[model samples]
Target: MGLLMFYEYLDKVEQLLEQKKDIELYNYLENMHAADIAEVLENLEVEDQTQVFGLLSDEKATDVLEQINSEDFSSLIKALTYEKKVTLLDLMSQDDIVDKLIELPESRQKEIIAFLDYEDAEDVKQLLVYEEDTAGGIMTTDFVSIKKDYSIYYAIETLRAIAPDAETIYYVYVTDDLDRLVGVISLRQLIISPPNRAVDTVMNENLITVNVNDDQEEVAKIVTKYGLLAVPVVDDSNVMLGIITVDDILDVIEEEATEDIFRFAGTNEDEIYENDDTLFERVRNSVTSRLPWLIITIFGGLLSATVLTSFQSTISANATLALFMPLLAGMGGNVGTQSSTITVRNIATHAIEGVGIFKTLIHEISVGIFVGIVCSLLVAVAAYFMHAEYHIAIIVGIAMWANMTTASAIGTIVPLVFKKIGVDPAVASAPFITTTIDLTGLTIYFSLATFMMANLPK
Candidate 1:
């Protein structure tokens, strides 16, 4: 719904709550999607959130629980009795249950576990053993697999019986007698083929599978590469573990992208998700994430100051030189940041490898030179008109060109180097590039001015 509609809904909810019209509120929420309901709950008071949640049917409540934020989920779960909590959790997929349980305390986790059936408890325990960022952690155990010997008719029957619980039936996996993944058959293939055919005859033996320990990001890449609806997860022995659906891959992509963005901004996922209630707590969280990078920039600034100090005589002789310093430094920083952001994205997508790295560097350098020439000409013209000093104009133009070209090189190389050393390239991007460019740009600007003023005609 539109923002205005949601606001109108919120006002209606508040009014209904104020009048103690529980049935009316329940009726109002009946037609809403779980996601929209979750959104509404987010805007409500904690007590009202619990009250609204209580009015939902068990099925809707379970779906809503999966959709709400962790804080609201925590609050609502706490309000439920143990039996009710287990009932709701039982309706959730294994991976989703594990995801929700992770936000609770250890004791609460244990309590919730205690209430689950033995099978469900075991599955949750097994899933929890994998790191949250791994394929095993994100894959849902609810996948349909049939033995290779089963007739196509029987396989369809099996799917009919189990499809309700399966994450996706679009691609049903084929396994050996020992339950090792051997082949896969899509729903389209299943329906079009002769029903009496053996599954092995129709199934494609070639499979794209991820190991249980593979990073979620790597899993996303494979899914996108193949345009798969779901990919099977396997153990090192090729035993079928679970399947990660396209929906989960989408979540991983969003999460990794968000994490990279936060890193580039000198914060992190924790600070982005932090729900501090007071201004002081918010300020403290902000400082904790941002202060370190600003400190690094401060030290970088000191190095820039040293360069300026060394060029004091040059600045005094042609005081006009200082006018264009900001332009040079700013342009260098902008170019460097652009190069670094693209390089980091390429690294994340595994697009730039050995030969590609050289190609990318060359490409960026060419672009930098092109951009530098255009920007330098404009700055040089501006300098000539403002100061009417040909020496200063030439100095500024040359400095701008050199600084921009060098900035591109630094931007490209720093991320590559960081990746080589096992650092996240995104985290090393903007701040590091900006600081390095600032120091280098000033040195270039001053050195060019110093040389040209001493040797060139005034």
Candidate 2:
């Protein structure tokens, strides 16, 4: 639903809740999609959220359960009866069931596993063995595979029998006698092929597959690069394990992007997005994530202060030089931040690596030189007007140019260095880069002013 429509429904739901009109509320929700219902539940009070979830039929309840966020899922699960819990778990996809189970404590996860039927319980246990950010973790084991030696007609028959339980039937995998993935046959291929031909005759052997242990971000990249609806996951021996659908890749993309954004801000996502956290708890997490960076910034600021102290004589000779310090420093910091943001994004997209990193550094430095020229001219003109001294204008202008050019180099190189050291490029971050620029830019400005102090009016 559009945001306005969602709010309209929320208002109506609130009114119904206030009036204690349960039947109307149930009927109203019946028309909404599962995702929309989940959104509404997130907005409502916990008691009402549980109550509304209970109103859903078992099928709709299962669908809504899959759509709900981790925190809300936990809250609603606690309020549900054991039978209802099992019913919903059985109806949910195996991957989604594992996701919800992951949010629980080990003991709680074990308890929930025991509630599942034998096959699903085993599936959850197997999925839990893989890291949550890996291809195996997000993949569904419920995919159809046919023997390569089977006739095209037999393959079609096999697919029909398992199609109801399979997560996707857009492409059917063909396996060897040893059950190794050998080729893939699309639905279109099966439809046009001769019925008597063997599955391998028409199947495409060229395949793109990910190792079960591969990172989810890499898996997402593969899915996007190949325009695949789903990609197969394989063990080290090329044994087909499962398939990761495009929907799961979308979630991975969102999760990774959110993590990078938080890291770029020099904070942790858990600090801000912890569901159902108390205000005090949230603030504590925020402080824990943010304090180290703030401390580093404080030290960096002190270093800038030391630069000023060293240049005290120059500033005392003509107080006007001090007036342009902030402007010079601020512009350098801004340019540095822009360069760092672009570099971090390139790293995230895997667009910059090896030789590309050098190319990017050169490109950013070239950009900085041009940007510095334009900014220097504007500030130089302004400085002359403010102080009525040509030397002051030249000092600020040259400092601006030098600082910004160096800032761009620092911004580009810092993130690349972090990446080379096996750290996240985003950890190079804005505040850290900006502070570094401030220290360097101020040093350049003050030192230049000191050189030209003899030219100024005594």
lDDT of each: 0.88, 0.88
- Indicate the worst ten consecutive residues by lDDT in candidate 2: 268-277
Q: Write the per-residue lDDT of candidate 2 for residues 70-166, one digit (tens) a residue.
A: 7788778778899988888888888887888787788878877887899889988999999999999899888889999999898899888988878
lDDT of 1 by residue, 1-458 (tens): 78998888888888999999999889988888888888888988888998999999999998898888766777788799887988887788888878877777778777677767898899888898899999998988989999999999999998899899776889999999888999999999999989999999999998999999999999999999999999999998999999999988999999999999999988877675344357777777788998898898898899889989999998887677777778788889889988998999899989999899999999999989999999989988988888557877888888999999999989999999999999888896777888889988998788777777778865
**All candidates: CA RMSD (Å):** 1.9, 2.1
Can you tell me which runs of candidate 2 are displaced by over 4 Å?
Answer: 17-23, 78-83, 273-275, 454-458
In model 1, which range of ten residues has the least summed lDDT? 269-278
RMSD of 1: 1.9
Clashing residue pairs, backbone N/CA/C < 3 A, model 2: none
Error of 2 at 6 (Å): 2.6
